[model samples]
Target: MASEFELIARHFTPVVSGSRTGVCLGVGDDCALLTPRAGQRLAISVDTSVVNVHFPADAPPEAIGHRALAVSLSDLAAMGAEARWCLMALAIADADDDWLASFARGFHELCAATGTTLVGGDVTRGELAIGVTVMGEVPSGQALTRDGARPGDVLAVTGALGAGAGGLALWQRGERDMAHPLLMRYLRPQPRLEAGRGLLDLASAAIDVSDGLLADLGHVLKASGVGARMEVDSVPMAAGLVEALGPDAARRAALGGGDDYELLVSLPPDAMDEAVRRLASQGLALTPIGRVTADPGLAGVGEIGPHGWQHFHGGAS
Candidate 1:
């Protein structure tokens, strides 16, 4: 059995060696040290995933590792922050060497792809859980927030929705086709990092859709002291969602499914074309689904319904 330090040395330390950007000291230290660039503020967020709660106990270790950090990075994406550093803490029943190596591969793959450095973290014996604290740098006074939305702003989303939830549904049905788009969506969600940065100066406010679209949009509405009117027909559904779940169920899932990881942005109506054009250049779609209003609550037409993931209250649709 490998001790905790041995586990980290063999599987984690090597991967943390890239990028000396803002890291004063990284990994293998009493504490990771960092220095933000001039005129930049650090956007930090932490997310945790537990076995059988956030993911299936039998899920592939690689997928688990990727999701643990990916979820945390989504927060930075919402704030239009550039990835910089991350610290991970792991609790597992045993120090399984192969599992740890595979997990490290998955975790480091994203870090390398995004130019984020693994700073430091802890490992211990306990129930299966992974927590990650990710830090990113954003220009001072320019980070996006939920509260910046306003009346007459257009609400838009990057990419389609409901795929993650649809993937979960397929997995629950004992379908293990890894090649399936929806299935992979459940296992590996890509955070909209580049698209989010593109929206920094364009969007009045932004949030990543970890909860369902309607539910997460509500946060922006409340924070901005406004309401919304959505055209359900305009809300983009994940490719193959309608085929997998039918039009009605697919629409419902797109409305309330969690783990989408796409950015929901609010911007002025006139800026919609430019925002869409910018994301389109990056080969990503930005769809306008609704508009903010001066009213106090949400109102919608078509088959729009208010639903989303609320931890401990109700499971995701």
Candidate 2:
């Protein structure tokens, strides 16, 4: 009944009222204005998803929308920044009302749940793609970084892993009814917002596991100028994952497969227990996978035969 812009202005614009700080004006204007708190610093991240690249071309519209935002939010979580606002840019090959409706519904559901607001965005007609730029805030000098890890720091991750990769494998093999919970894990990953927030002070460094745990942890090790030892046996696995894919398959997916959107953090040895307790209070589980090392290199501990997924190197297993 209304144009795309009108639909956004009417339904999405109202969500902007949730912004508590740093938003001078939101939505409807030529440009949104933001002013961060005096002692806070702004953290911004943008992510883009292309058809058949991030998700299947025929993916449910709602799943696509949820993922488009969830991936961006994961970046904020990694930085231990408070969720604030987001801007979206959409390029669509076709404009189907039903698709758009489902997408909007999923997007808004996640935004509301995470205390994030969609302030403004642009929509265009083109090849199908979605880009979301998210902004968050944290106390100055408090945002976590990949470079803060130190030798002897413990490595931990929030939530289970390998479920998404397993799910994708099942789906591609035409096993849609594969009784594994990995399907839902693949479709909708629960970003570790509360766990990340709790680690703001405790974590020496952090990153989200988008590029598989091993590869993403390698980035952190490189940035921090240190080495790490990941205990493969200690890595958390999603329920029913091992049973569905065998222990090796589950292990490979957890180590190499990406898209879990969980937080991987380095914490001082002394803070490890406290960090776990805090996250538990928030109803999250943090798994201690290993410890940082002074070797100045990356090494997988325990029975980690090989690492997780590589974008260009092709799928593992």
Candidate 3:
């Protein structure tokens, strides 16, 4: 059996950036140190996933690693921050070297792609679980928030919705086809980092759709002290969702399904064209879903039954 120190050294230590610049000390140190860029505000968020709760116990180790970090990074994206550093805490049932190495590969691959550094973290023996604390920075006074939305602003989403939830449905049905788009969506979600940064100058308010489009949109409306009227027909849905789940069920999933991780934004009507163009230049598309209104709550979408995801809505199923 490998000791804790040996496990970390073999699997995680190599992923730490030795770049001696922004990070003073990385993994192997008692505590990681960092220096934020001058004139910028640090944005931080923590997220955790537990086996059989957030993911199936039988899920591939690589997907678990990718999902844990991707969920945390989505928060930084919602704030229009550039992801910089992340610390992970893992609890595993056993010292499975192969599983550990594969997980590290997935985590490090994302860090490399995003230019984020692995700072420091801990490992413990327990049921399978992963938690990550991510840090990013945005120009002072420029980070977008849910409160910045206002009446007459147009509501838009970075990409199609319901993919993650649809993926989960397929996975739960015992379908293990890794090549299926919905399954891939559920297993490995891509956080919208670049799209988030692009919105820093244009979006009045933004949030990532981890919970469901209508549910998460309700959050922006509540914070901004406004209401919304969605053009339900215009809501962008995941590819092949309608064909798989039928139009009504697919629409329902698109509206209330969780785990999409796509950005839902509200911006001025006059700026819509420019925002769309800017996002398009980066190979991303922004679809207009609705408009903010002076009323108090979600309108068209809310009238439909069963909105958004909640952790403990009922007794254990």
Candidate 4:
């Protein structure tokens, strides 16, 4: 087996060795040194995905790698920050060289696309999990937070809801082709970084829809000290969602199935049109599903049971 250093050097180091931008020091050091743009505040978040729990044990390495960075980057998106650098800590039972190469390919492709440089991380032997820490920047005092939502603010979401959950359902039903839109949505989540950043000045508050839409929006309402009423019909479904899962199941998935990395935001009712227009200009969709109400709990979509996935609660997203 190759030594840990050998593994990192072979698979990870070369990606960082050339063309240092905001990164002053790359993979060779104990800690990566990164520089943020002037007059900016740092936004950092970390996420870990475990085998079987977060994803199937036999899923492709590329998907796994893409997912690790994508989810962490989603956090930055929710805050309307610009992604700069990422660190990946990989724990595996064996040092499979081929797996490392493929995984690096996926991870680096995303980094390149998003202009994020990889700086530092670790490789260790363990139960097979990946942890990604993403660092981003936002103009001082301009960072979007969940607390800014007001009681009258209109609640909106980017893209479709339930695609992640719908994709997971398809996979559970033995669909493995990554080409399927649902599967790609589930396996290779595209963080809404562009939309998030564009909506920064417009959105009063924002949070990523990692958990179910209801659950995640519940968080925003809680933080903002507001309540909300959701129009279930206003919630947009993915293109193929209804046909694939049937109406009832699709409704359930859309309502509470989680794993959707779309951004949920609250803005003044007047700002809603601008937000929607901005997203459309960027070739993305923004939908108004509800309005902030008092306190927290489902209102417009009445008679709904418990929803969303929370770790350690035995719920799957």
Candidate 5:
């Protein structure tokens, strides 16, 4: 039998298949080869998860695997790109066969579900870290960017918010039983891939809500060089989040808590109805939460709370 490192290099590294449009030489090479289609652009993103930083060291292998990929895939969704391939790098503290198997199963399952393949990566022994580099493709000029929002464009979100933050709170408080669905939502977030695809032609600007709504939207604002006015009452909240965390707490979490992985988009006012209808046709909902404004300040309409996740303000677990 081969050593653990050799086993991974031999079997796992070469597990993925090649793509006709994107890949020229996939695996078993000193360097992978890629060639983009004539009118297509390749979108690439990398996400990292450390044992204690991102998740508990003892966190379920499958959940860790799922989250590792899901977070990276979320970036693809943000760009309105179609997921194509991924490269996974693992740093394990120990060589546990069971853990590795479970993680691989979880990761591969998600890859298949999203029509993406594991193209290449490396495995090393270290302090239990995982990094996934995802590649996606979109039409050369059709890819959505944060810089496209204009004044009067409607600010919208693809799905509910606050549930993951609420679930995290419950988990930290040892009230796991109480959170129920919220807890699951925190552990296994679904990337809004279909919503992203639907918004490709509709949204003027787009981003995924990984760092809470306000912060993520701020990214769009910065990129687009515009300001926004968000309607507090229009922001969608998950069912039972307010009941569980109380109205104030729920509002804060929904606005500022990170890791929701929902799609945030800006669409022209005239296109809102058609955009919503297109998403609806794909069994997704686009909730209009606010509008782009000429004023270049972070302002909100009604009472939308403090406006999304902050890194140093204490929310990460």
Candidate 6:
């Protein structure tokens, strides 16, 4: 078996941006040296995925790598930050060269696509797991937060919802076809970075949909000390989701499902047209799901029970 350092060098080292795009020093160092851009605030988040917990044990290595980093970046997107660097810690059962290479490729591919660099991380022997610490930067004073939402702001979401949950639902049914759109959604989720960046200074509050839509939206309401009214028909469903899960179940999936990774934002009513136009230019949809209200608690979307993934309780996210 190859030494631990050997695996790191072979799989991860080469992917670091020698160009130093906000990185002063990358791998092979005790601590990753980083430098934020002038007049910008650092936005950081960490996400951990465990086998049979976050994902199935038999999931593709490539998907595992992509999903881990993507989840953390989703947090950066929620803050309207540009993803810059990431550190990945992997705990694997054994030194499987092929799996490592494939995982690395998936991780590196996303890094390249998102302009993120692999700065530092670790590899160890244990049950299959991945922990990604992602860092990004946003202009000072322009970072969006959950507390900024006001009663009159319009609640919106980027792209569709329920796809991840729909995919997971399909996957849990013993479906192994990786190519299925729903399954791919569960495996590979695209973080809405561009839509988020464009919403800077426009969105009053923002959060990524990781836990189910309603569950995460409730988070925003709590932080902002406001309430919201969801337009049930306006909540976008994932392609073919209704056909697969039926209208009622699909509605529940969009409302109460988790792992979508889409940005749920509260934007000023005046900013709605611009926000819609900007995202539409990029071929991404920004739909109004509801409007923030002065009262506390959620209204509309009748009786959509128990949404999102809860780790302690084993719920879908």
lDDT-wise, the better of 1 and 4 is 1
Q: Write the per-residue lDDT of candidate 5 for residues 200-313, one digit (tens) a residue.
A: 888899999877888888889988899988887788987778987999889877887777888999999888999889888977778999999988867764454344247422
For residues 193-256, could you state the per-residue lDDT of candidate 1 as single tens digits? Answer: 8998999999999999987888899889889899999977899999889999898778777888
In model 3, which regions exceed 4 Å deviation?
1-5, 15-21, 302-317
lDDT comparing candidate 5 with the true structure: 0.79
> What lDDT does model 6 reach?
0.85
Off by over 4 Å in 1: 1-5, 15-19, 301-317
Total clashing residue pairs per candidate? 0, 3, 0, 3, 3, 6
- Residue range 72-95, candidate 2, lDDT tens digits: 999999999988889989887665
Per-residue alpha-carbon lDDT of candidate 4 for residues 180-203, written as tens digits (9 for 90 to 100): 988898889999899999998999
RMSD after CA superposition, every candidate: 2.2, 3.0, 2.4, 2.1, 2.8, 2.1
Using all chains and alpha carbons, the TM-scores for the candidates as numbered come to: 0.94, 0.91, 0.94, 0.94, 0.90, 0.94
Model 1 scores worst on lDDT over the 10 consecutive residues at 308-317
TM for candidate 3 is: 0.94
lDDT by residue for model 3 (122-206), tens = 8887898889999999999999899999999999998888887788778888989888888888788889989999999999999
lDDT of each: 0.85, 0.81, 0.84, 0.84, 0.79, 0.85
Residue-pair clash count for candidate 2: 3
Off by over 4 Å in 2: 1-12, 18-22, 175-180, 301-308, 311-317
